[model samples]
Structures are given as C-alpha cells and as structure tokens.
Target: MSDLGLDDLAAELADFAPAKKKQATYTAREERIIAGFEDIERFYEEHGRLPQHGEDRDIFERLHAVRLDRLRELEDCRTLLAGLDKHALLDRAAVVSMDEDDLDPDDLMAELSGLGEGDDITTLRHVRSAEEKRAAEEVARRDKCHDFEKFEPLFKQVKDDLANGSRITRPFELKAEIRPGAFFIVFGQICYVAEMGEVFTNPQGRTDARLRVIFDNKTESGMLMRSLQRQLNEDDAGRRITDPAPGPLFADKADDGEAETGTIYVLRSKSDHPVVAEHREVMHKIGVTSGSVEARISGAEKSSTYLLAGVEIVATYKVYGVNCQKLESLMHKVFASAQINLSIPDRFGHMVKPREWFLVPLHVVDEAVERIRDRSILDWVYDPNAGRLVEA
Candidate 1:
C-alpha cells in the first residue's frame, strides 16, 4: 500500500491527465470571412478610413462596403472578425439597407437576379429588335486581339493606300458574304473583318455571322454580318475596300491597231548621287505600261518623275488586258514605306517630287507583281527587314 509499481503509477497519471484537443481546420465559409476581414483591414490601413458605399464611391470600395455589411449580419462572421477590428470598423454605424427609394429599379433587379455573378439571365428582359438582338450577340462574342501589333502597321498601310488612291472603295454588294480578312468601309470608316463567327440565323430568319471589325483608327468592334450589311445599305457612304490594282498606264499599238498588253517594269537609276549610289541595289522605280520600256524611260534625265536620272530597265513582265495604271499604283503602294523621297529639278527649274521611286530591291518588286497577278497581294506585304514578302 505504501509503494506503487511502474504500471500502476502510469495508469494513475493517464487517468488524471487532461485530454489533448484536435487542431482546428477552417471551413470554406470561415475562410471567406477571414479573407474578407483581411481585405477590410488592408483597406483601413491604406486609407485610414472604412470603405463606404454610394454611386460616387469607387467600385472596389463599394464592394468592400457590401462585404462588410454581409459580415456584420452574420454572427459567426462577427465572432471571427472580433479580434481583427483594431480599426474599430465593427463599432461603426450599421449599413443602411437599400430600398426601392435608394436604388434604381434596374439596379434592384440586377442585385436580386445575381446578374453580376455571371449568371445568364438575358431572357428576363423584354424582347429585343432584330438589330438590337444582333448587337447584343456581337457584344457577347467580343474577343481580344492577342497580336494586334502585327496587324497595326498593315491597317495603317491600308488607310494610307486608301487616302492616296492606291486602294479603291466600291459599293458593298448585298450578295457578297461577309468573310474573315475582308475589308469594308462603313460610315466612312474603313473596317477590316479580322475574324468571323459561325453561321446562324437572325431573328428575321436571315443567315448572319459575327465579325471582329477593326477600324483604321485602332478602335475595334464586334458586329453582326446583317447589322453591318444594314449599315452599309443605310449609310450610302459605305463601301467595300479593294486592294491596289496598279495594272498598266500607257498603251502601244499592235499590228491589228488594238492596244498591246502591258508590262510591270522595274528600272535602276544610273545616277551618281550619294543617296542613289548608297542604296543602288534597293533604289529602283516600279511602273506598269503597255508601251516600250525604252520609250517610257526615254529622256528620263529631263523628268522629275525619273529623278532627273537615266534609268536602265532592270526587269519586265508581260501581262494581258489588266489595268496597267492600277498595277503601277499597286507597286508604288506595296513599296510605299521604302519610297525614295527625292526632290529633283525639272526642265522648268522647279523642284518636283518623284513618287514612283522606291528604295526596294528588284526581287521584291517581282514578288509583288506576281502576287498582284494571282490576286494574293492583298494578303501579303514586303517585309523590308526580312528582305522577303510575308503574309499580312
């Protein structure tokens, strides 16, 4: 009775000792409350004031204010946040409940419908007109351009081409289907259809498509095919933009007294000037004519259009009944960025700007002509950096 064994002593200690408690894990609701409280604490620390609500208040602050209201109403949340109320935010006046008098009907509806949470309830609204429905569909289909920079320069060039008469705008045809990579002018703004959506029927039972319409001003819009069609029809100024033609200029007589076919010609300057010599390989004039190249360059030293320099015909390609003038303009437009800004004195002793000369290689001119022939030049550009033609 006086001395206890080791087993008996251990049993006595175990029975007298307190039970160990399990570690606590936060529930999803508790975690949300903790996060919300932390956000409020951060806001208070930064601004030295609690978040407030109203239309005049910032969106984030309004959200925080709403969150605070919800937290204050929940007993569990208040208990969890009791220790975090170092800013005395919990002791502040309760959030006033918004009634019909305090909020717009639409806002009240939006709040009750959980529309802000990304729930699709578009059908709850009144029936939309054909145009309105199409517009809404376009808005829902909006996408961001990940590589807009790659296309920005191309868009700029197209605008320039349009302004300088290198590209032409014709009436948009009703029969022509809207397709990706097609260019159109709507409300006097040049719109490029960079992307297209799936085929579907509009409320009017007409086939329609959604298009990513990029404008020359760098602004973009998602629009419906029918909507755009209606715009083009209604806005008499709308037009379908066409690529540069630059086919041929002057014509020569054939044996049958008919105009002979044209040629896309590249000519190299024989000038001894510094700029001309420095860029000799790339400095050339591109032109399209149905007449002889020799005749075209004849007396070139007298004309400012030839930079008052004699030009030797470097390359030439024959073509049939295409618009040579349009083709020449197309070549000029293709190499517009590289065009040599040379001002030379004409026979009249007045300085004149020669627009046809470009600081581009002969091979590029050949490729451009080939592309123009195949009607593929509209989709490609001469990348001076790569020294080759690339798809736009």
Candidate 2:
C-alpha cells in the first residue's frame, strides 16, 4: 500500500468510533487483529513484498480480502462505532487518533488473514529464560528439606532445662526439636522458635511480629493454614493439637471485634529492670508492637563502652499473591546492623518455614545486660505477658 493511502486508511481506522455499549466489549484480541494489519503493511514497505502472497498475486486482492475479514469480525465493533452519537464519536475519536502512529497495516492484514495477531507477538526471549532459572531455584529449595528429626532430643533437653529454671549462658547455641515443635536454642533458656508466625524480641525491650506463624482464618494465609492443619491432623493421629479451632493465635481479631482466643502477646518490662525505661523511649521513637520488635545492646565488656542499640520494626507491609519474599527482605535489613547472633538450625536456620515465621536470637554481655534489663526484649523473654512464647 502507498504511504499516503496507508496513512489515510489508518486515519479512517482511528476515526472509526465504537458505540458506548460495545466499547466495553472490545476485547484485546480484537484490538490485536486491528494492530496486526498495520504491522503487515509496515513489513511490506520494508521488504518490498506482501507478507503472505508476496509479489506473486496482486496486492489489492490480498489487502481487500484481509480488510473484508476484519470488517466482518469487527461488524459489531463497526456498528457500535457507527451507532455512537456525534458527540460520543468525537470524544472516542480524539483518543483513537492519538494511537494512529502505532498502527501497522501489514500486521492488521495478517490478523485479518488469520496469520497472527500483533498483541500475541513477544520478543522477550531472555525474560522467559530468566523465569526458568527462578523456577529451578524454587525446585532446589523444595527438595532440600534438612533432617529436622535429628534435633528432637536436643530440643527436649533444652525445654526440660528451661522448665527447671536455667539461667541460659550468654553466647550459647544449640539445635533441637521440642516435642511439639523444632527450635534453635541460644544463650541457655533463650530459644528462637519458628512456629506458624514470625516473632522476635530485642535486648532494648522491643517486639516485632508478622503473619508468618499465626493464621488469620479470614485471610488467605489462614485458609492455607486451616487446610494444612486438617491434612496434618489426618496424617498423624497423635500430632493434632486442636480440631482447627479459630483463635487469635490462628487468626486475627475482626476490626472492633474480639477474638474467641486472644492471639496478641503484649510484652511489658518489670519495674526493677532498668531496660524498661530505655524500652519505653525506644518504643516511642519506633512504635512498639507485641507482634514485631527486636532490640540489641553492645559495649558491655569495656569500661569506656558505648551503648549500641537497634530495633527491627515492621514499618509497612503489603500482601502480593502468596509470596513473602518482601517481608523476609524487610526483616533481614532490620537485623543487618544489630550485631546480635541468631541461633539457627543447620537445615532450617537459613530456611524460613512455609508458614512465614522467623527464629531470631538476641545476645548481650553481662555488664551491658543492664542496658537491656528493663528493656522490652528481656520483658518478653523473662516475662512473656500475653503471647504463647512462655507457658503460663
């Protein structure tokens, strides 16, 4: 097609108005057909040959046939455009006119001839290859489930010790499974338990929590947990904890509504603890929550020591299609500069549980312990108020 003729056709196509009722019905597929013809014309101009028939047959028949097919397929579209009142046509035409530069007559004709649609065309071969790499990584992670069973005895031992009142030594670490669950123990009685949700306490008396461990029945996570709970209950007769009861631990309380079982665990410092005062200050600065917070203090062994403190608080969050990578990245940055050592299992330490929880351990020396004594982390550890971290 001549450039001027193609331009005139494009202008006509652009001006072709769709009826209000039919405008919403125009599918992407239909638009692709329109765009395909435009591309075919462009291809012909570039190579000096029609796409399908090439220079063998007269170009007019090929062009006419394609246009006729498009017109038939777009009969409803054309009717809709024609039926539009003058004002509506002018309004729609203004927008379509702007897209005139995007039209390709060759592509449009190709779509009409049932060769190909312009919208279906993709040149991102590399993007598809990259997606394959990510898929492979996910498969590896799934297959590499470390043997958590071996740590069972150690967990029992630590739980027993904690039950008997042990002053967990500083910088101590061990991997164990505590009968009902598996956990990484650090600094004696202190343990980092990866349950159904993410919970952490800081040395300066702060807490941070996320939707990792806890389930919200009303939420998508809650539904998955409920299903998993049912499957687990069916798989093991003795392992079932409850008959999928709705509680705060498993679901969030409705707005302005109370939960049948309270899930929120609030940590408060004791009066005698000096860290309590510091915790209150930190809490004010970074909004304390029973769900999320971690505090750290350094400079204990030196006489001229400086108190270094940091807290991992969840600032803002968004749920995007079952992926918790964003939340994990946020938690990693929160603890990045804290200088506290987290006791993680060799197998599960680096791995986050499917339920979306984290096991974090906070450490401090004896002298600087005062810096965190009244702090919220200690309050959480020594006297876990409302949450299930410490058994009543």
Candidate 3:
C-alpha cells in the first residue's frame, strides 16, 4: 500500500463530520482514538518514524495496526469535536432571526398534543407518589426524634435573656442589646452600633417577640435608642434609656466626659487591635524561619572569629555580552563593595576560583538558579575556583 494513500485516509477520517444524532451517541473511548491518531500523524511527519510495533509483522500488518489504533482515537475526538460544533451552531442560531417558513407554532402544538393527555396524567401521578413517599419518610423521621433535654436549659436561658432586654458582650467589646417590641436587635462594633427597627413583621401586623443581633466591635458609632414604654403593659411608666458613647472615642481618650442630657457612656477593652495582632504573627513567622542575622552581629568586636560559609553570589545578564576578563573584573568590584574577601589561585587552567564568597542560606542558592535559568551564562560557578581570568 502507498504511504500517500494512508496519509490521505487519515486526513479524510480526521476531517469527517458525524451526524448530530450519531455525534450524541459517540462514546468517550472513540473520541480518544481520534485524538491519538492525530498525535501519531503529527509525530510521523516530524520524526519520520511509526509507533513501536512487533518486528515480525509485515508492513501491511504494521500499517493496519496503526490505522486501527488511530481509528479508535479518532472516534473519541469526533465525539468531543461534534459537541463543540453543536454548541457553536446553537450560539449562531440564537442570534439568527427565525424565519416563519422554518417554524410553525400550530404544528409544534399538534406534535406536543400527540404525546397524549394520559402521559401527563401518568407523570403527575408519579410525581405525587414520590412526594407522598418523601412526606411519609419525613414524618417517620420526626417520630424518631433525638432527646434535646440536655440543651433545654441553655436554650431557655438565651430566650429568657432576650425577653428581659439583656445584652451580650463580645471579645471586641461590642455589645448586642435586645429590646422589647423590637423585630431586630442592635450591636456595637468599633465606635458605632447598628440599629434595626420594624424589620421583621408578620402578615397579620403582629411583630416578632424575640430579637437577636450579632456584631463585631470594629464599626462606627451613633446607633443606640431609648424606650419610652418602661413596663410595656403599664400605663405612664418610667422610661428605660439605652445609649452608646458619643463621637470618635479613640483608645487614648480619657474616661471623664461632660454630663450631657440623655447620654450614656460605654468603655472599650484594652486589648491589642487587629493590625497589631497581624504584625506580631508576621514577625513571629519570620523569626522562626530566619533568626535575626543582623541582630546577632550587633555590638560585636572586630577581632571576633566570624566565619561566613555557603555565600552564593549569582550574576545573570550582567556578564552576558562582556568577555570573561571583564566579567571577573566586575565581579571583584561587586565583592569589594559588599565587603567580602576575594582570592584567586596561581597557575590557572581551564577553570578559575570565584572572585568573591559570602555566606548565604541554601534556599537562596536554589532561588538564584531558578531566577537565571533562562538567561545566557558562560559558566555556573557553585564552589570556589582559583585561577587567573581568561577571555572566553
């Protein structure tokens, strides 16, 4: 068989489009086969070699095997390709104007009617049966209820506190206050508190008895209220006052304030702020990873035995176009600037000792290699090399 014929066959198979119905029916395995064939064909053109096969097989058998494998892969690709094509067609169809000749409303209605009223009735019956079964299961589950007696006291306490107009204070010094006849409660955060009035109401014009609020202590001020009705049921009773501290109370503010009419004062906690907490965590993490190297050398004598090992100094495009001699000279200058010592061995051969050495973490060496991997390099000097700089 001619190789050209096989190539043409492969191309034709790849370009072939399946019908919509057939596309939907295509298996995932079939699509994978088509994809494999395409890869194999591209490989054949690039490397001029076929996939590995039994040496004992003749050319015809080898080609047959390859074609069979490619066909399987093509089937898989075709399924996915067909789905993409269908989606593209659908998108195009969405923007296109529907012609009257292409669609008949009456015909569609007649076709739908052909499905039969009995079919709809049967479907409804099945749906109702499922719903009934679910309801029965739910009722049975309710009958097998777990004992909540242990949690009754805690739940009762929360209910009683809300009914008694009590407040709960959070760690951030924010307070949530529950008021009588209130649908929603208010809470203070930072210097301010949020108030909710007439928020929850029943359709019959009755307000909810329970009120709850959750607030963080990191908000603005000016959201407290006073109740005119003291005894709720009693006529002409004494009023109850609830108020937050006035305007921008900073942490540095004093406790003393001028007596204002109908005003109340609330103090903030002396706890560290969020920003301070975050800064402390960051410093802790850094200290755990890299102990303060600069702090260790502070106030040290000049004659102290300080050995700095594993100093990795990497340069990338810095020496790109420059010759080795210039590179060495530049490196020596950098070392001198960094206050690092430099040494070169006599009787130089192909390699030379690095011009400078300083102590650095092993991780730093890995980081430098990763950064300059794409750049031009004459040599990779990891260890100390001693020799006179030679021109590259």
Candidate 4:
C-alpha cells in the first residue's frame, strides 16, 4: 500500500481534504475605517489621553473624538480592532458628547450595514467616509472683498490693539462667537466677520449661516459660520481677539452693555532702571480704576509707583459683576510669586516701593484675567519658572 502510486494517493487526499480556505482581507472601505481609528491611536500615543469631543477642541481632535466614540459603540469596529486595542482604547468612556446632527447620516448607515464602498447596488461611484467629506470641507472658500477698503482699517486697528496688548487673544471656541463685527485670528490672519447672512437650517437639521469674513490681506471669504468655526478650531494658533472689556456688569440702573464700572490696565515702564530695561518683556504694572485708563496714567513719569517714567499701556480687561478692586486684588494674590520689587524715589526724593508691578509676561496676565472671569483664580497660583498658572 505504501508503494502504491504516490500521484493516485495525493489526488485522493486532495479531493478528501476540505477546500483550502482563503485568508480574510479587508475591503478598501473597511481598511479606511480602521485607518481612521489608527489615527486616534497615534494621537493617544502622542498626547497620552483619549481625544475628547467639544467644539472648543481642535478640529482634527474633534474628528478623532467622533471616530473614537464610534469605535466604542459600534460592534463591528470593536470586534475588528479588539486585538489592536493594546491601550484599552475601546474601553474608555464613550460618552463624549458630539454634535452629530450636522454629520452626514449616510456615514452611520454605511457603518451599520457593514458594507464596503464597492457593495453599492446602484452606482459604482466611490463613497467617501465622513472624515473624508469633512477633510474636503475644511478648505474654506474665499472670494474677493469688493469693499476691502472699509475693512482694511479695522484689521490694522486689531493688529495694533493686539500688538500693544490693549486687546488680547483667546482660544477660538464656538460658532456663536463668529457674529458680525467679531475679529478672529485664523491661520495667523485677521478674520473680521463683516456681515452675517440670514440663519438657515441645512438638510442635516443643523443651524447655519453664511458669513462675509474679511481677511487681513484684503482678501475675503464667503464661508459658512460653522466652516469658520471648524477652521479656527482645527488650527493650533487660531484665536479670538476680545473686544475691550466692558465696565462693571453689576452696576445699579445699568442698561444692557452699560454695566461696566471699571477697566483693568497693564502698563510697561519706560524707566531707565536696569532691571526694568533688562526684563521689559516680562515686567508689567497691573491696576484697576473706575475711570479712563488714559486719565489714570496722565502723570505717570512724576510718580514712583509708575517707576518714575512714562508708561505704555499694554493690556486692559473690563470688569462686569465683580468689584474692580477685588478682581485686581485677586490677580495680585495669584501672581504674588512673580511680584516685582522696585524701590524708586518720588518727586520729593523719598524712596518708595511699588507693589502692583509684576515680573510676569503679558500672556500670563491674560490667563489671570480669564481665571478671574471664570471664578477659578482662587484655586490657582502663578509659577514664574514655568511661566504659567497652576493649581494652588
């Protein structure tokens, strides 16, 4: 039997064995879904945290947040990526609240059906995933600003305000923040929201409006309100240039927008003092007053409190509900670690020590104001070495 023809035995065994099974290969569409999730993995690896969802978050991060949310919820995705979840990615909190209303409904439908782009019955046209659709939409459409002359001045003023710290920049947060007359820095360019068209709901049941945004370069864009929000959130340096803060918001008999009682001003000295000259970028005098900032500093050079020199106003914040003095005190206490020590002679020649001037940067002052506004300054303190605010 062993000697019996080898070819005949092989043929019998080939017919007897079960047909050789082919190894599973993913479709292009399936590959894409995993690829998108892989991006989140890479982000987590780079950042050491799962992507969290919010309009205030970066655009790509938000997309990753949405993608991660799906990975946690979808059975197919969880199963396919179960082996690759070395970081327990799929097990993290999937409760990230995302505004999925604006997202294309077809995305969810295709995901649920577990079908590839090639499985379409009617048309062989390629179907794009939600990420692709969004990536394509990221390219903002710019048009010629017919009356760029009018907006050119506003842009110049904002740049000047930003430069002098009269106006400060904050992270871009929402679509609602993009109303007419608002100024934003997107991709390092000044984006002035000139006019807003009528609000309308798209087919996706999301509120939207068209905006006439004028850029710094005399170029303009007719981008949607949400599109600008997306662009700003996606950009690392995108920021909103705040309007000059209004006075105290808690004043009695105050009409809307008339409640501001005072402004907080930051001043840089023109002193010939060695320390002041050496650390000019980080030195600042912080104070609050119920009158005009210009009027407050009218006789700065004669006062030792002003470092015995003319002072340049660098930043200002308007107070609303809180007392200007109290808010000023709060900021001083928080930045106590970075307080500047300056002993100067008054007009009478007696030495005087100034207390309000600090050894912190302008951006740190901006953060303090934000903390004061949010009522969180009490829980934090300034770290001069790190040059940032940290938990107290």
Candidate 5:
C-alpha cells in the first residue's frame, strides 16, 4: 500500500463503494396477472365472498371468476403470487389455456397496453366498486320525486313572483355564501338545501357540512356539505341559484352588447301624483329600446308606459343578440305581480292601464336583466318571499 500511486488508491476505494441495486421489472403479462389478482382481493374484502359465475349473478362477478380462472391456469402467475396468496386462491386446477401463437397479435398488444395504462379491463364489463355504484345510482335517481304535489305550488308562486318583479337571480358564490336556504342545480336536477349542519373538516381536510337537500322532483338526500359542493364543482352543469335580494340585479356598467342590440332600462316616473310620490322606490317602469333611452323618453308625458309624465332613468342594461320586443315582453311579465294597477290618459284623453308599470324595487329589475344576459332567466322564476330565483 505504501508503494501505491494516488490513482491506485482511488481504484481501491471505488471497489469498496456500495453497489447500486437495479430496479426489479416484470413482463407485461406478469404485471397484468398481479393487477388482476389485486382486484380479486379487493372484491373479496368488500363482498365477503369469492366472485362467482352464473347467468343470474352480476357480470362483474362473472368477469372476476374468469380472471381468477385464467390466473390459476398460468403457472407463472401462481409462482409470482406465492407469498401474497394467503387465501390459497391459486391452488386450483387450470380451467383454460392458450398457446402464445394462438392469440391475435393486436389483441395481445391491446391487453398489454391496457395493463400498462392501469385501465381496469373489467370496467368495460360493468365491474364497479362501491363508490362507482353510488355514482351510478345518483345519476339514475333523477326521475323520482316523491310527494311532488307539495312542491308544485311553490313553483307556481315563483313564476308569479318572477312575473311580478319580486325576486331575482344573481351569480352563485361558494361556501360561506351558500347557506341553508340556498338552491342549486346539479346533474340537471334543481336541489334545495333545506338545512345545514355544523361545518367540519372532511377526510381530505376540506371544510364540509351536513345538508338536507330537497330535489325538484320531490326526492331528498341528506348529503355531506362539501359532497354537494364537490359534485357541483366537478359536474360541468352544476349551478347555484343565487339568493334573491332587494337590491339592483346588477350594478355594473352596461356590457358591449348594448351597442349592438338595445338597452333594458328601469325608469322611475317624475310624476308628482300621490300614487307615484308614495311608492317611488317600489314602482318602476321596465322597458327595452333599440334607440337611445333619453330620446325614447323625450315624450314621456304622451305615453301610457311612462305614466303620462316625464321619467328618470334609474338603471340601464345593454343587451346583445336579443330581440328588443321579446325582451320588453319578458320584463313586463317579470313585473306583472307588482303592476301599479293605475290608468293614465294619453294625449288623446283615452285612459289605459300602464302595462310596464311595476311595484318592484329597481335592483330586482337589474338582477333580472343579468339573468337574461346569462340565458338562465328562462330556467328560473322569482320567489318573492324567499327573495331569490328558484328553478322553473
């Protein structure tokens, strides 16, 4: 050692360095057999019985039976599972066998690809776990609404309130914003959260609540709070029904569509009449016009919609890709419940009821326009008492 050079000493040290262990790899077939066996083990744990085959049994159980049979036929599979075969499932006789040359090349490639991608080959065969079965049931339960008669009148009242200008829908907010009385649409069914339990941490550490959710068709479910939230967030069609409020529907500036289509305007009459002066805040004239609002209201004293007097524009929403006539009609319908019920004389001295006159708050009109903008107005109706939009 004393006679050795630096390079010789380094070589000796390298020889004592720890050897790097190579990774263990399995052939495609070996990987597939292991995955198949794991599925069987899980199935046994959940069902408390071995998967069986029969025309009356579930297809998934039959597939499991077939998979088990194939695994037992392969000696290599049994050898690989020797340590993991605590259930002695691999001690059975071979039920089926095929030569390597007998399988179609494409079929073999697909099987290998399915294994590598971790796709459960049994999934296509209608094999499902407990969670999967629950999800399927959720999707299929949309049609049943027990005691729907109790909810039918509620729907009717909402339509009346929507027509009367008492309720409006706004964009939904999350969590703290969603309370016990809120409504939502998930998986295409309108759901109402009748009550909420205390907020608590879920298994994933996210905040959750216990909710009693009533569906539109009369069915109800007591689901975890965030469970509904998760469904809403993950489902493409999930939407919350904004709580109705007494303020403007939307306080934002007019959108770009106003330039192309027309403006949906909320107006308060400047008439000093006792009726108009008393209910000033509640009474409004909601209308749509393709032309300038200022110019349109220039001869306010001559028209019945303006209450035969000059009017102040309280709010205006620019609409795009809309039929102004149809929009005006919709607005008129929304406030029909709150109609002023007064007759005004035109320049010709003919008295006529001002159809556009509504006793709704200015903010309600604004929110209604927002619903129209989002194309959700058609699916919602106002609930005057609840002060929110409910599913139509």
Candidate 6:
C-alpha cells in the first residue's frame, strides 16, 4: 500500500498531538453541596466521628449535620458526592432511615419555605432559606488555600501529635496570646496561624494584629487577633492546641492571676445503680485535680465522692492560667440545675451525697467550659429541661 507521498505522511504523523482537554463545569449549587460535604469529611477526620446536630454543638458541626441530612434525602446529591464519601458517612446515614410515614402533601409543603416552581426559583430574587442562613455566616468566611502544599505536612504532624496525646486542646482564653506558628481548633477546623503582623492599636484602644490563618479544610483567612479572640470567646468549642513541650499556654512561669493549675476531668460513672444507669449518658462527675486523673480515680469505687462506682474517664481539659478551684466552682454553679440528687448508702450504712455529678450532656459540659474560659459562665446557667446553658 506504499505510495509516493508515504515518506511525507510519516513525517507529519511523527509530530501529531491531540488538543488539550477543557476543564469540566459544575453548577454553583452542585459545587456548594460538595464543598459543604467536604467540611463534614474533615470533621470526621479530625474528631473521628460524624458531625452531630444539637443546639449545644459547634456552629460548623451543626451546619454539617444539617447538610448531611439534606444530602441523604436528595438522591442526586448522594450520587454527586458518592466518590468522595471515603468514610461511608452517607452509607451509615442510610441505616438510620429517616422514615416519612405521613402521606401529607400539606405537611411537606409547610417545610419547603423557600422552594418555588420552575426556573425562576434558581434566580437570586428568592429569599435565603433557613438552611442557607444557618451556614451563610461561615460558608464564605475563608478563601481557598492556594499555598496549602506548604502547610499540609504541618497539619499532618499536628494530627499525629493529637492522636499520640503529645498535643492537647484547651478553651481559647479571652485575650489569649495569638502568635505565629500556633495551632488551634476553631469552628470545627484545625487552624494554623502561619504569620502574625505588626501590632497596632484598634479602634477600641485595644492592641490588635493581623493574622495569616490557614485551615485544614484548605482555606485561609487574613483575620485580626482581636476578631479571633471575640470569635473564640463566643464559640462554644473554640480551642487552642498547645505546643509539645513548655507550651505557650502552660509555661514554666505564669504571671499573677494566670497560674498554670491542674486539669478539668469529666468522668462517667460505671455504677450499676438504677439512678446512675438511667442517666449514664448524661451523668458526668466534674472535678479539678493537680495530679494525674488516673491516679486520682484508681479506687474510685471505694469512695463516696465517686458514688461508690467505678468510673470511666470520658474527657480531660487542661486548665491554664486560671484558679482551678474557682473554675471548678463556676462549672458546678452553671450546671446546678442538672446536679445529681442522691442519697446512696455506703458500705458502713452512711448516707452519701454526690455533689459534683451533673445530668447535663457532654457537649453542654463542653459549652460550660467555653463560658468559663471567658468568665461568661457567671451570666449563664445550665437549663436541664432545655439541655443547654442559657442566660441566667
């Protein structure tokens, strides 16, 4: 089949190249849905659990929890994000099975407040839905981290340190020092302070500095130190990750009224008693200790302070630059409504009353800790019926 022009054709084929492929396009709604789900994934990775819905939960977690619910309901959303569900978050959700037994269109229509018919609904003229409002505050808070590669390894190491207990998280103290190279957990994300700018007097005559903060979700914020302080004080779960040795928060030396004390430990009673068994999910013994918690509770079952029950260490919070006794008293007063009322008899037939036991949920306890950090616990009281800390 060779021809006179075969040599020329072979030369042209040698330089043949295909055109570059164009990037795929996605609708904004689709993109936002994926972005929202990714937050849930990051939450799972950092905390090793799915984001939960509760008034007591962090705002970011609450958003993710709501987003997860919506994703599970929409087949298209699940299909779109199927490839990225490495944690089977969606798969586990299916088993929960949100059953809709009532065949009432009127009830269904009542819940779809912002939904409208036809393409007009897609226009910006529509009011923001309640779900959007819940997440809108933070959805666009940070820009994409273009230089994420430079900080990814640091994130990995911090995560490892947390897993091994080398790094610890405590409530972000009010007016707490925010400097470069510090790690923090804020709004359900790992935030790294990459750089700190020159300190300048703010409008309120308070010292403030601009920060280059990078989030583990591949987002960055050029935020101010005072703004972060205010945010952390307001946020129920905002925490600072302490350094490995001689931590910035817990140093060898502390100034007046800022002494590094002990830790706040939450223990779950393992007692087989009816009262303890009934409220075990929410029952926790809150205490402060300067010594090791393990050593403190070694023979917990033998003591009336522990309700003559073996205890499981549920959580520990490192207290820094604060009076432990005052902190412990503040928490007890905050959760006074949920305080356990019992008169269990000891082995010697002596009636014992456990004062530190609280019927409040763990997350609420966490919120209490946040309030204590900023001394806002003074104005807040635990509402047992509502299961949250409310204005006193």
**Top model number, TM-score:** 6
Q: Decide which is better by lDDT, 2 or 6.
A: 6
User: Which stretches in model 3 have alpha-carbon errors above 4 Å?
Assistant: 1-25, 53-392
Tens digit per residue, CA lDDT, model 6, 62-123: 44565577777678888888887998898774212111111111211211111233333221
Determine the C-alpha RMSD for candidate 6 after optimal superposition of all C-alphas. Answer: 16.1
Q: Write one digit per residue (lDDT tens) for candidate 1, span 187-217.
A: 3345678888998887889888887787544
List runs of model 5 lying over 4 Å from the truth. Answer: 1-259, 383-390
Question: lDDT tens string, model 2, 1-392?
Answer: 55668778778787676645643554443443343444444444555543332111233324333433343355454454444322232122111111111122322221111223332321111223343343233222322214444444544454343222131111112111222242221100112223444445545565433222211111112112232333222221112111122222112224444323111111222222244244432221111121222311121111001111222232322222211222222233332332222222112123111111122222211111232223322222222122122211
Q: Is candidate 1 or candidate 3 better by lDDT?
A: 1
Q: Which runs in model 1 stand beyond 4 Å of their true positions? A: 1-259
Q: How many residue pairs clash in each candidate?
A: 14, 48, 24, 6, 12, 0
Give per-residue CA lDDT, model 4, range 97-156, as digits (tens). 443422222222211111223332111122234433343343224556778878878866
Candidate 3 local lDDT, 1-392, one digit each (tens): 64568778878787676645642453333332333344345444545544332222222223323343333344444444444442232122111111221121221121111111232211111123443343233222322113334433433343333222242212111112334322221110011112345544556674433222221111122222222111111211111222321222111222355321111111111113343233322111000001123332232222011111211112222112112222232233322322223222222121222222233223333333333333322333323232121223
RMSD of 1: 24.0
Assess every candidate by TM-score.
Answer: 0.35, 0.14, 0.11, 0.36, 0.33, 0.40
Ten contiguous residues minimizing lDDT sum, candidate 1: 110-119
Best-to-worst order by TM-score is: 6, 4, 1, 5, 2, 3
Q: Which portions of model 6 miss their true places by more than 4 Å?
A: 1-33, 39-136, 246-392
Q: Which ten residues in a row have the lowest lDDT in candidate 5?
A: 108-117
Model 4 regions lying over 4 Å from their true place? 1-258
CA shift at 294, candidate 1, in angstroms? 1.4
- Where is model 4 poorest over a 10-residue stretch in terms of lDDT? 106-115
The TM-score that candidate 1 achieves is 0.35
